[model samples]
Every structure is written in C-alpha cells, then in structure tokens.
Target chain A: MSQQKILSRPSVGAFMSKYGIVVIFVGLCIILSIMSPVFLSMRNITNVIRQVSIIGIVSMGVTFAIITTGIDLSSGSMIALISVVVATLSQNAMNPDQPVSIVMPIAIAVAISLLLGIILGAVNGTLTAFGKIPPFIATLGMMTVARGAAALYTRGRPVGDLKETFTFIGTGSIFGIPLPIWIYLAMGILAHILLSKTKFGRHVFAIGGNEQAARICGINVEKTLVKVYAFAGFLTAVSAILLTARTSAGNPTYGLSYELDAIASTVIGGTSLSGGVGSIPFCVIGALIIGVLNNGMDLMGVNAYWQQIAKGVIIVAAVLIDARKQKRG
Target chain B: MKKTVLVLVAMCMLILPTAIFANGQQEDGKILIGAAMSSFSDKGQTYLQDGVREFDAENDDVEVLMTDAKDDAAVQLNQIETLLVKGVDAIFIVPVDISALKPVFKKCKEDGVKVVIGNRMPAEELWGEFDVYTGSESIQAGILQAEWVAEAMQPEGGKVGIIMGPLGHEAARMRTEGNKQIFAKYDNIEIVMDAEGKWDRAKGMQIAENWIQSGANLDAVLCNNDEMAIGALLAAEGANLADDAIIIAGVDATPDALEYLGAGLDVTVFQNMNAQGYNGAIAAYKLAKGESVEKWDWIPFETVTPENMSEYK
Candidate 1:
C-alpha cells in the first residue's frame, strides 16, 4: 500500500505542476466563450491562432534562453531592424525584375536575418559573460540601439513595394492553416526536440539550475549562454520576416511591445521569471491565452483603452497565481 | 584651452551684433513677427518653415523671428516670452498642446500682440482670445472618406473596419467621430473592429491581417491617415483579399497615397498641406501688419479616386 501511495504521489505532483497552466487556459477559454458568443466560433479561434503565431514563435526561442537563466529585452527591436532590411531588399528585387526569382529574395532575407541574430546575440553574450554587465542592462541597451538603428534606416517612413510572393509567409495557408501558424508550430517542434532530447538542452537546464555547479561539471558556461542568446536572435528574425510578409511593408515601428508579450507568455506558462524551468507547449499555450483575450475583447466591443487595462490585470493575475505556486513549493 | 577661448570669443562677437540688431530693429518701423514652431522634424517643421519662408518672401515690411521648441509646450512658452520681451508686433504659434498654450495666448492678449494660431485649435475661451485660428477640419476629412465609401458600396452597405491613429490625438479623435456620424446614417453598414494603429504602417497591417483572419467579412477599411490606409492595403494584398477589391480609403494626400491612387489601389481625401503652410504665413503676416482678420478660417479638401487620380498625377 505504501509503495502504491508513493508511486501515486509522484504522479499527483507531476500532474499538479505541469497541467496547471493548461487547466487555467482552458478555464479562461470557457469563461470568455460564455461571456461572448463570438469567442466560440471557429473563425475567431483561427484568428486568435494567427494573432498569437508571431509572439509564440519568438517566445519559443525565449523559452530556451530563459531555461538558462538569461533574458533578451532586445528581441522586439531586433525584429524591427531585421524586418526593414528584409523588406527593403525584397522591394528592390521586385522592382528590378531580375533573373533571380522570389525564392532568391526569401533565401537572402533568411541569411541576413540569421547573421543579424548571431551578431546581436554575440554582443549581448559578450557583455554579460566577459564585461560582467547584468543581462537586463546589456539587453536593454541593445533594445534601444537596435530600435534607433531601425528608425535611422527608414528615416521615419515605411518601406514599401514588396513582391506578392514575399508576402505569402504572413498571409498564405496550407490545408487551411495560416503559414505563420505553421512556421510557429514547426519551430516549436524543433525547440521541443532540442530541449527534451539533446545534451545541449541538459546543459542549459543544468546551468540555469546552478551556474557554479554546472561550470564545475565542464559545461563551458560562457559558450552555452552565447548560443542561447544567438538562438533567441534567430527566432526574433523569423518573427520579423513573418511580420514583414504580413504587412507587405517594412516599418521601423513593427513589433513594438512584442518583447513584453513574449516575456509575459513565458512566465505565465510556468517558466519561472527567476529561470530554471519552462516548456515549449506551455509557452505556446500562454501565447494563445493572450491571443484569445485580445480577440474576445475585440468581439465583445470593449474599448481600446479598457482592453489594455484588462490585459494588464490578466497578466498580473496569472503571475500572482504562479507566485503562489512557487511559495507553496 | 587658449584656442577654445579664442573660438568662444569669436562666436560671441558674431552673435552679439545679430542679437543687438534684432532688439534694435524691433520698434514700430520694423514689424517684429514672432513665430513659435513646435518641432523641427516631419510635418510640423515642414509647415512652420514653409510658412515663415513664404511670409518673408511675400512681405518685405515684416521681419519674422522664429524659434523651434522641439515639440515642448514649456519651450514654446519660453520662446513666446522671449519674443514678447523683444517687443514683437505679433506672434504666430503652432502649439504643441492646445490646452497648455492658453496662458501664452492670454499673455499675448494682455501685451496687445496679435496671436495667430496655425493648425491646432485651442479651447473656446483661448480661441475667442486669439486674433485668428486657421487649420483643416480633421473631422471633415474623415466624413468625406466615409461618404466616398458609402457611395461606392451603394445599396449593399458593406461591412467596414477602421485602423486609426492614437486615441486622444485631435486628428484621430475627430476623424473617428466624423466617421461615426456618417456610419449612423447607414442602416446596413456595420463596423466590425476599430483598432489603433498608432499612425504606424506595420501596426495597421497587423491589425488588418488579424481582422481578415478572424473571418469578420469586412468589405472596406477606412484609416485616419494615408500611412495606415496603405498598411491596410498591404495586409489585404498579402492575405489575397485584394481580389475582392475591398475598398480602402484614407485622409492625407501624401505623395505615396497619390501614387497608390494612380495605381488604382486606394482612395484618399486630399487636403492642401502646402496651402496650410502658405495661408498660415499670410495670416501671420497680416496679423503682424496690424490688419484685421477673422477668428476662424477653414481649408477645403477634395476626395480623390482612381477616376480623378490622373488629375492629381
């Protein structure tokens, strides 16, 4: 009997800890649907998914970074910078009608975004690891610098004239699933595999749990942290490209406030703000919760100002619940 | 240190005469027209500079002294005080904040310096206090766009959405209110969503795409300005909804908006921005010359569509 009880205790604890976010998400969904009939419609659900995809994609990368007890406040601004470059390049390509096809533009955008991500990540990682600067300060500086650079690039105007094919990633669908949503899912799957199956993932968790101990165990702490930020940058670039495609224009102001949403979603999904714990699926759920709340508020005719206030309240409530869980532990 | 001091002394020598001459020339023989500009970037600067230049070009009798407050109400007030101290005949102000500029207007009235406000309208008491108020009616711009949409959609009375600028901004609020007035007249028309794009293109695109993906069955979109309207067009094109020819309309006859209209992509209400600059100068010049002027002056706007876009082109 004691053996059975002991076995059940682990299962119960696991259930309580892991499934709690999912339960709350479900509960919120039900309540919102009851409050507004439009919330339950398939169309609205699809809309919510589409709206969440960009933030969800970025948060997946953030989940990996946060698992290592690091933060990236620059992701939002980085997305803006990379997006303008991508859009400007694509616009030029469309106008000249060069021998190179649409695929060439996409390939070029991807390469440029990857490079930008690595460079930005390297800057942040170097400051935090070598210069002994705090992660918050380093990333915060990067955020302002990147946003300023984006504004300078466009000179406070929107870049336009992108080819139709380039916009497909944001608007196109396969099997009735929007392309951004699919891209987000694909990235999420890859992230899940990397975190759950790889030695790198284990190292990340170890470092996040206790950096000093992880270093003693031969974890090459600095390199791992750099790689995590680089990955975050990569994800931010992808979100930027999708945003550009969706807008069919490159704008310096794109993705404003995205970092906050990403961080909020990560924390809401049981990824402790202090770090050492996170799951891809849970973070995705957190993003969806935000998406649903925005969509429901719109459908219910809530004023724009009030919607912002509601979002703040919901975020606070979710964090409070998480805080309670941590206290109990 | 010696070189720095020498350079500082040289700069002071160059500036002292200009300052002294300005103060000396401020008497009745020279009409001192003080201009308080909001900022030196984008539309505000463009208008203020053009106004001052035009005023100087047309009238040799009036000498315009200008100060840029960089969009700070406090700096603008200080600039007014400095201009007042110099004993200017009149002051032209493009205020940063309409409400906060009242005391400056009141001070101008007490000093008997005619105050001509450009672009922004102050509260009723301040308006009554000022010599002349000139600006485009932003609400009329919105109503004009809505009326065009209503005509295009005709009997079906299409479902519409709006991508608006920031709330509480005069232009945004007035445009929205004007659109609502037109919307109230249409029995079949329904507004699905009105999202704040914050006068940003990407934000407009995001909101537009979301509205489309939500299956809102939207037939048209009206933006408070051309920037957001272009954004909506891009989003609709990205979503392949452009084939439906969802009507898109905006205010502000910017070059890009005109280009889009020429391409048969969107409609716009063309306000005479250049005229706003020119007429503002004329008003300021008249006030400085001690000529009587009306308290309020209205600038007209024309609706531009694919059919008449060639004329603008």
Candidate 2:
C-alpha cells in the first residue's frame, strides 16, 4: 500500500495542480452520493447530466472567450434569440397540416443558428475591435438588444409545435445516454482539440496574457478577439437550439439569468476571471459540480431559497480557492 | 444625409398617428375606460382585452382604450397619466404594483374619474375609495389545492413539497399562506421543502429534480402555478419516477396543465381568469354608466383532475 501511494503521489500532485477543479468536483460528487442514496442511482445521474448539458456547452464557449481576456454576457440572450428563429423556421418547415419530415426542420434550425451566430458575433467583434467599446459594455448592450429582439420576434408569445426529431436532440438519448450529454461531450472534445492544437488558440492565450506584447510579436490582436467572441456566439446559438428542443417551446424569456450560470461555471472551473487561463474539461467539471449540487440539494429536500444560498456559497468558495492559487503563483 | 433624412421621416411617421388620435377624442357624453395592463402577452391581457371587446360589442357608448404597462410600475404610472389627460370617464387598472399605483388611483379620485381595480387588490383604504374591486382569492387557490391533497392522501398524509414563485409577491405569499393553513390541520402532512421557482419552469424542474435526487421521498408537490407543476412532472419523468405517481397539483388551469391532466400526470386549479376579465369589464362599464357597482366581487374557481379532465377537453 505504501509503494502504491508512492507511485501515485506524483500524478496525484500533478492532477491537483493542473486539474484541481475536476478533483474538487469529483469530491463533491462523492460527498453528495454518500449523503443521498438517490444521487448514486442511474436515473438521477442521467437526469443531472441532461440538466447540465446546455449550460456545459455554453460554458465551453465561455472558456474560449475568457482565455482571450474577454467576456460574452450576450450568450444567454443570443440563445433566446436563436431559439426563436429556430422555432419559427422549424414550425414553418413542418406545418402541422402539411407536415414534412423532421429532418428539414432540424437542418433549418442548425443552419439558422449558425448564421445568426456568425452575424451576431461579427457585430460584437466589430464593436470591440474597431468601435473600441469595452468587452463588458459591448456584450451588455448586445445582451439587451438580443433579448429585446427575441421578445419582439415572438411578440411575447412562445413558439411551439416542433417536430419530434428536433425535440429528440433535447429529449431523446441513445443507449440510455441523453443526446444533450453527448452533444456536450462532442463540443468538449472539439474545444479541447482547438485549444491544444490550433494556432488561433495560441493567439487567444497570447493576446489574453498581454495584448500589446502579442501585437508586438506580430499577432493580430483585434482579429483574435473578434474570433473569440464570434466563437462564443456560435456556441450560444447551439445552446439555444438544445434548450428549445428540450423544452419543446421557445419563449422570449427562456434564457433569463443563464449568463450568470455560464460565468459562474467558467469561474468555478478555475478559469481566471482576469483571463489567460482555462480548460474545457475543467469547465465541464465545474458545470457538473453545479448540476450535482442542484440534484443533491433537491434530493435532500433543501428549500429553494436555501438552495440559492448554497449555490452562492459554493461559487464564493471556488473563487476564493482560485484567488489563493493566484496569490501563491 | 439621405439616410438621416429618411430616419427622421420614419420616426415622424410612427409618432404622428397616435398624437393625432389623442387630440381628436374628447367628448363629454363618450364613456372612456382606460385599462392599465400588466403586459400585452400575458393571459391577463388576453382576458382583459376579450372582456373589453365584449363590452364594446354590447354597448355603443363605451369606448375602451388600453395601454400595456409591460409589467413596469413606472410605465404603468405614465399610462395612467396619459389616460387621465385623455379625460377618461372611468379607469380600470390591473396595477403593476399595488402600492405604487395607489397614487395614480388617488389622483384619479381627485380628478373625479371612477376607478375600477381589476385582478389585483389595492390597500384597504383604496378598496373603499375605488368603485369596484374584482379578483380571484389567491389564498383560496392555495387552500383548495391543499384540501385536494389532504383528501387524496386521506387519514395518513404524506410528505409534500411546494414550488413557489418569487417570495413576497402577493399571489405567491397568499397561496403559500393558504397551503400552510390547510396543511397545518393534517398532522400527517409534512412539508419537506418550499423553493422559489421565480415563476420559471426550468428552475422549478431543477429544484424538483434536486429534491427527488436527495431522497426526500416526497409524496406530492404543490406548485404556485401550472408552469412549475409541469416542470415538476418533467423532472419526475426524467428521473424515471413518472410511474411512481407522485401527486402534483398546481394553480392556473393553463392549457398545458389541462393537457397534463388529460394525460393523467397532474391536477390543477382553474382560476377562471376569463371570468375575472369579463366581470372586471362589466364592473368598469357599470361604474361608467353612473350605476352603483359592488365594492368587491369574487370569480368562481374549479379543481381539475384526470377524472373530470374530459369535461375540459
């Protein structure tokens, strides 16, 4: 046992230093499971994963944005806006009276969301890069504009009557694994690849670490920031699609307060709020931590007000740990 | 330069018509009723508009002008001012904030326009000051749901959870209080948790799912609204406990809740919002006609479950 401990010590230390958020998440899961028998059950675990998937996907994009010293508060509102567009297009494509196959609606939704992401991201990018608005103010304005546009688009009514196949992305699972979880996993893998292997990823970190230094080294700082925000927009659109599918309805108010959750997850995952550091996997773990807390608290019969208090406490604790790590470095 | 000119022209086009209409309609014999709506999209607005239209179709002399406050108390105050300037004969307000609108009501009283408060209660003094007060009893909504759960559970009650809206909102407080009162009588009925969903479905689902996962062994859930109840049902379904048949009850007989009832998944209390609107309009018209309107009016409520779900269908 001593020999085993010695052998594991280096990797364990490396993990704690490198992926401390994941370790903390694993610890939280263990504690929750021990405290509530239902937490260990397959059904409850699946439910938790499904619940976390949309936020997880959005957090992944936020991870990218934070790496470049930028933020995207408009993500939640973007989701609402894109979801309305998808819902409208899907409904029109699959008119109940003359119902087309579900594939058409799904395709339309995907296309529209992607296009919207590009256009909205470009707008955000232009404002931050050329218009010279601070990231927070730029994104804050975008957030309100997007949300208001969504509400206006739907005229304050929910857009419903979606095709079954479209809803499947949100509601269905393959081999007992929910589709949203799978989508989140796919996005995570893609993000990991981009961050670890791509030149753009290098540009993001370099610009975040020191924009002037990066520009002195011949990096196009403006372009990189634009790309980062644009990518965030794309991810927001994807999250919106998934949310719409899950609910089977799209209301203008759908993504209210979601931005806070994304930011919280990013921060909890050890992403430096000051920028220049973050990992997709760590962010995923952070989201899972939140998901498990929500699930466990419910299972324990914690009141709603107390659940919010507990969430706030956990976020503060995570931020404190991050601050301590920064001080040590 | 051309673009700027076009923009200016467009702005003027949008503003001109409303300005013209406001100046044109000022007749003494005309019965003008001003409606302050919470929002144009809410069920309240739909019911209120339907009621006004019905009144207009029946009575030729009454012309109803409506403005949506968009759930902003300040905006609602502005709307009241606009109505007052139009010299409306009677004002029917679904106040965005009961207290904030009190001043508007007082001003209307000073202006000598009869005020009819709809779907919400003002302060006691305002109730006496207003011509008619019409709304459903929010406490009764909670009591009715609790009573149903008590009867369903019978001599041996079970664990109950409540998914509420924002704390201190009149409806949320009243419903919660009513439920507390009814549940207090049954020693076996223990409330395990009460969480605010803030009138959000996703939050409600998350709260319900978390509770179920914690092994709380909840036998029933009472939600402040149908949206939260549906959220609880979805959470239960996700947890594969839909088969467990945990009784879920909610206020608001929304179409979705009615459908859930038809599917045998949930029960709901129908507040008859349409009747509230219909009556509010009638009261407004009566006060406008120089007739004495009742000080308070109550609309009927009904309990809907799978047994009588077919009737709603």
Candidate 3:
C-alpha cells in the first residue's frame, strides 16, 4: 500500500516541466522590470509583442509539426521565397519620381503566395511520407532549394517600392494593438482548436506516440504527415507576407536562419523534441520569453557580443532546468 | 566498397551548382572574359554584374562569362579553375575572400591570363597580383558620411548613436572605425550609444526603438547601411520625434533611401556600383588586349541629399 502511494505521487520534474515556460516568462519580466525603467511600459510591451509576432506565429506552426514527431527546417527559406514572389506581384511597376506609388491589388498576390506556400509544404510532406525520407533531410533539402529559388527569382536584388495599401497590413494597428499581434493571437486560437478539438490533432499525437500502433489503429499516417508539413509551410508564408510588408520591401536575403528561432521557441516552450506532448499557450510563452530577453538586453545597453552569449546561456539554462526533473522521473 | 564510392560521387555531382556550366561555353571567334563574382545574390554585386554585362554588350569582340561564387570561397576557386581550363583571355574577379584568392592569382599568372579584381579592397601586400582595382575605399565611405554628420550636429555637437552591421563584417568594422575617428575630432560631439543591427530592417527597427526609449540625449544617428537608417527613421517617427529633431545618415544610398532624402534622412553616401562594374570590366578587357591600365583606378563615394538626389537618379 505504501509503495502504491509512492508511485501515485507526482515527481518535481513533472510539475516543473509542465509549468516551467510560464515560470521563466514571469521571472524574466520581474528581472527586466527591475533592470530597465521602460521594460514594463505599455508602448514598450506592445513593441516587444509586435516584434515577436512574426517569429511567434512561425513557432506555433512548428509546435504542431513537432507534436507529430516531425520538423520544419524550410520555414525560413519559404519565408524568403514567398516574400519575394508576393512582393513582385504586389509591387508597383518600375516608376521613377516618388517611389512609394500606387500598386496592383494585392488580394490575388496574397492568395498566390498562400497557395505557393501550401504547395511547397505539401511537397515536403509528400517527400517525407511517400518517398520515405526523414523529416530532417527532406526539409533540409527544401530549405536549400527554396533559398536558391528566391535568389534566382530576383537575381539577388531587393524588390522595393511596394504598394502602400499592402504595407498597412503589416504596420497598421487596430485598437492600439498592431496587426501582426492580432494575426498572432488569431492563429494561436485557431491552432489550439485544431490541436485539441479536431480528429486530425488526435491522430498527430497518436502518430508521435507510436507510428506503428497509429497505423495499425487505422490512422492515415502518410496523409496526416503531409498535412502537418503543409500547415507549417502555410504559417511560414503568413510570416513572410507580414515581414515583407513591414520592411516595405522584399529581398532574397530576408528570413535568414528564422527557422532556428522558431524551433528554439518551440523547444523552450516545453514541446518535447521526442514528440507527443505540447501546447499552443506554452509556445506563445516561449516566444515571449525570447522577445523580453532581447528587448531587456538592448534597453540595458548590454554589449552585443555578450548579448549573444547571454541568449545562448539563457536558452540552454531554461531547457536544462526544465528537463532535469523529467530525466529523474 | 566500389559501389559505395560510386554512389557518393554521384551524390556529390548532383549537389554541385549548374551555374559553372550555365555560361561557360567559349565561342570560336570571341575574346571570352570570365567574371567570377563573389555572390550574385547580393544586391550590390548584382549591379556590378550588370556593369560587366553592359561593357560586354558594348563590345562585339568581347564576351563576359560570369559565375556566381554563392559566397563560398572554395566554390569560387573551383569556378576559376574551370574558367582557366576553358582558356579565357582575362578574368574580372570579385573575390569571395580576398586572402583566399592567392591560388587563383597564382594560377592566372601561370596561364598568362590578365586578372582584374573588383569591389573588395585587398591589403597593400596583395596589390601587385591584380592589374587594376575598381571600387571606392571602404574607409572613405564612413569618413565622407561622418563628415556630413559632424557638420549637421553643429557647434554644440550634441549626443550621437550608431547602428552597425554584423560585428565581424569587414565593411562594418571599417565604416565604424571611420565614424568613431571623425566624431572624436569634435569636443562637443559625444557618442552616447551603439548597437549591431545585423543588416536587417526589422532588427534595426527593434534596436532603434530600444535606443530611443532609453531617454538618451540623442542628437544624431549613423547607420552603416541605408536599411538600418530607414529602420531608425521609422522608429523615431513612431516615437513622435520630429523630422529635424535628430540627424540620420547612412552609407549605401539605396533607392528607398533616396526617397526620404531631406524629408527625414539628412544625407547618405552612394558607393557607385555602376562605376565599379563598368570600370572593372573595361579594365579587364584592356588588360586582355595587352594595354596598360592604372593599378588603383578609384570610383569615389558621393554624398546624396535632397539637393543632389536628382543628379544620382
């Protein structure tokens, strides 16, 4: 009876693992508030979230991909490809004298970019599922191919002088909240619904838990994997459009190493790299932690080199502390 | 073991860029000049390639064959070897790494191929390897830009902030050195803060926002590149800072930068990519024809502001 009681008792690792991301975020906020006067201001807080929203949205998509025991290294490259392609379609024709002129309606451009992202993502999914390539290798190949394609499309030039109306989607604020943050919130809510309430979401967890068992239980594992990757591609395209609009130009060099940032956020949020257990809320918190750290470091005039070191240290420390209890359990 | 070796070789072949052979064919009657550029993906380098292409189009006897290094030194060396094997008369090279071009220079010397380097400024020790160098001195860009900033800050001088590119980049280091050196000349002009923007519009905007909110007496902002300048401009505007409240200057006078001249941005330095490309190509052509050319043919950096922006256009 005593042994049964001990088995039922929860380990500290289990408790910490579940709540560590939130704890880290709260802890960071408290520390930053103490360090910088403007760290907790409303405008600055909005600034932090606005800056993070692009990468934050990408991290949410990565969370879903991870929950299925898959990865998306192509997010960064896809952003570049989609940014340049969409910019080309929406950009005002080459005009001298007043560069920021009127442009073509961007509705079609947005649709085309989204379609391109979905198709490319589906390609990643198909290669992994049908061709039996590992997710890492398949997405890695896509990453290279997409980046090369973006560079080739523009011949290494920036597609600047974009239409003003389209840029509003990136820069505009509604009710004092920026549109990127709004889009991030909307996507997070939608992702939560898709992951918790839908049958596809349940299948994702099942596949990550045990692929053979999921297959034996009649889950269409191949089709689901494709959908998972395709979804990640779609989210990446959303970020690409927002980023291009915000910058007021699209260059092939954009989104360099962004996938790593997205993955880092996902991992820090306590999404198991080994798969099957994660949540959307924790992913948001994960992205927020990084954003706060960066903003705080900048505000305090931390040396840029030391900031890089600090970032590396904090990410590792957060993951290590969170994982220690789990390892023991 | 043989099967494994064969498979590995095939995989390697599959991954190699098709760019080497894309424009490598030599015509029977043409003076083929190979142009091995550091990166075609770079916006500035693309313009340099265009300058070479313009030079090629103007002369019927000359054909400029260009190969992109894709920012890889080894790949650039491989491309040069292939060019050498095909027997080009002269080569216009924008080295991916100036130091690592020793092999290319040595090989070109052996083949009696005239070599003309562009864009990047090699050290004094390596100047004899190439016949001509057609690009502005990197240090001059920063000096010219900061000279304008020093003047704009006026007699009182006020506090200044700097936004630089990636920390270890050659251009960023040289440009920052020039900016700091010039600012040190004035007693009143004190540098309050500086940050690395990583040459991105978004990151620059973020850093600028942080600096603005820091309550420093910022009178001027100098950025290594125009993208970051524009970012700082946007951040300042977002903070409700007036147009003339702070002076902003950038190195590259990009088209987007030109739009804001005199309106918000004080001044910017134009690096003259067109001159670099055209002059470098012409020098290579002249060298191929056994004509002597200047060892250091300079294309000076020009300041662009509202008054002179039209001249640049």
- All candidates' chain B TM-scores are 0.86, 0.88, 0.89
| Per-residue C-alpha lDDT of model 3 across residues A1-329, encoded as one tens digit per residue | 97576567776655665686677789989999998888898988988998898899899888988988889999998998899888887776744432222355799888888899889999999999999999899999999999899988877667777787888878888998989889989989988888888999999899988889999999999999999888888888899999988888887888888899999999999898999988899998889888888888888878777888999999999888778755654
Which 10 residues in a row give candidate 3 chain A its minimum summed lDDT? A94-103
Per-residue lDDT of model 3, residues B86-179, tens digit only: 6788899998888888988998888788889898888889988988898888888889999999998887789888888888777888888889
Give the docking tier of candidate 1. acceptable
Candidate 2 per-residue lDDT over residues A1-329, each given as its tens digit: 97587557776454556656666777788988788777888878788888898888888888888877888788888888888788776663444422121335468668877789868977888799888998888989999899778867766656666777787878888998999888888888988888878999888889888888999999998887888888888878888888888776676767877888898898888888788888888888888888888778777777667888998998788667656654543
Instruction: Pick out the ten consecutive residues of candidate 2 chain B with the lowest summed lDDT.
Output: B20-29
TM for every model, in the order presented, reads 0.78, 0.85, 0.91
Which residues of candidate 1, in runs, are more than 4 Å off? A1-14, A32-46, A64-70, A92-105, A193-222, A325-329, B1-120, B125-134, B156-159, B187-193, B201-219, B230-246, B253-266, B274-297
Question: Model 2, range B88-121, lDDT digits (tens) per residue?
Answer: 7778888888788767777877877888777765
Deviation from native of the Cα of residue A29 in model 2, angstroms: 3.3
For model 3, the stretches where C-alpha displacement exceeds 4 angstroms are: A1-14, A92-103, B1-27
Greater DockQ among 2 and 3 belongs to: 3
Ranked by DockQ, top first: 3, 2, 1
In model 3, state the lDDT of residue B94: 92
In model 2, pairs of residues that clash are: A298-B210, A298-B211, A299-B210, A299-B211, A299-B213, A299-B214, A300-B214, A304-B195
Off by over 4 Å in 2: A1-20, A89-104, A213-218, B1-30, B41-65, B85-87, B123-129, B242-244, B310-313
Candidate order, TM-score descending: 3, 2, 1
Which one wins on TM-score? 3
